[model samples]
Target: NAGVIQTPRHKVTGKGQEATLWCEPISGHSAVFWYRQTIVQGLEFLTYFRNQAPIDDSGMPKERFSAQMPNQSHSTLKIQSTQPQDSAVYLCASGRDRGDTQYFGPGTRLLVL
Candidate 1:
């Protein structure tokens, strides 16, 4: 398996701009997770997918934050009207089951200007 891959290792966006981050999970894995990491908040769960369906998104922001699992192996997270408060390391993880240990990809760091 290829583990997990995340593109655009770093992103810079101006205030009010939009930004998108991509992720590709390990082959055959059915669970994927998104988390945001910052010095103050630590790691905050954003959303998750199981069997290509969203299972939980309770941790996601009510506005401007969205996540999608378009297929079995890939997912994306988009942030609209990017703000300085949105700057963080966006991490993608995947595993065979919800309780299984997840393998993390090198995160995409977003910097809002």
Candidate 2:
């Protein structure tokens, strides 16, 4: 509900295709969630959620990227029309609550060709 980042650690897709990444937060720790992207520019915030309700996704590209927390156990990040620049390590992290201890998962490495 709060934290878990997913999809694939290494995802290779062709340009103009679509890609969906998933994350599963730890059980009983679904109060706050956030996603980050690790690219050449360094890590950047992507989105955040509370109680599975979207709070902020302003970091995502308005045109092609979207994220969702459909349930308490998992979340997803979907990219429409994949592009070469979309390549990066997408991270998933969650916490029991805002300002609480957070845990991180292995990033899903996306390589758009």
Candidate 3:
């Protein structure tokens, strides 16, 4: 079964460090979503794309967080100057379209110390 793939299932970074998370969406899927899960926030939507173009990122942090889809196969989420509060499980999901059922990756758990 094809599914979204997330690299570096776990990451540990010191405060002020930079963290980059990678996601590979299911082949042929046109929509991708990024989310963050934390004890305080629970699950929070970060961004989403359609046809490899950003559709919305209003949920993303104004600073320090950025996401990009340079191609149809992959997307990346980067956090600059990572703080302890940035620690969370980053999730990636892919779907054929915005309304389609999204398949999620195993997620990457990041810890900032």
Candidate 4:
């Protein structure tokens, strides 16, 4: 079984352009998480879902960045009017639930110029 799949391993866009990233969680895993990593903030939790329902998203920016789990197997992160400061490695992970260990996928590296 594929542990997790993150599409578009690398993305580059001009400032103000939009970028969308996709993540397909492992089969049977109910919890999916999104994170952003940068030199300043390090690894920070962005959002998560359990049984396809959003649970937490306190770390996410109020605007431009959003994450959603449409179904059990896949989720998406969308950023609108992206800026250079938005460039970072976005990670997706899946696990049984909050207390269980989550498996991380190779992060999607994004660059905004």
- Residue-level lDDT of model 4, residues 53-77, one tens digit each, is 9999998899998888888979999
Off by over 4 Å in 1: none
Can you list the residue pairs that collide in candidate 4?
none
Per-model TM-score versus the true fold? 0.97, 0.88, 0.97, 0.97
* Candidate 3 per-residue lDDT over residues 1-113, each given as its tens digit: 55889999999999999999999999999999999999888999999999999999999999999999999999999999999999999999999999989899999999999
When 2 and 3 are scored with lDDT, the better candidate is 3
Evaluated at residue 59, the lDDT of candidate 2 is 82
Badly placed stretches (over 4 Å) of model 3 are none
Task: For candidate 3, give the lDDT of residue 52.
Answer: 90
TM-score of candidate 4 on Cα atoms, chains taken together: 0.97
Writing each residue's lDDT as its tens digit, candidate 2 over 2-91 gives 335565778899999999988888887755454556546687778877889998887888999998989988888899999898888888
Number of the top-ranking candidate, with lDDT as the measure: 3
Q: What would the per-residue lDDT of candidate 1 be over residues 1-113, giving only the tens digit for each residue?
A: 66799988999999999999999999988999999999999999999999989999999999999999989968999999999999999999999999999999999999999
Candidate 2's C-alpha lDDT?
0.80
Report the Cα lDDT for residue 101, model 1: 91
Model 3 C-alpha RMSD to native: 0.7
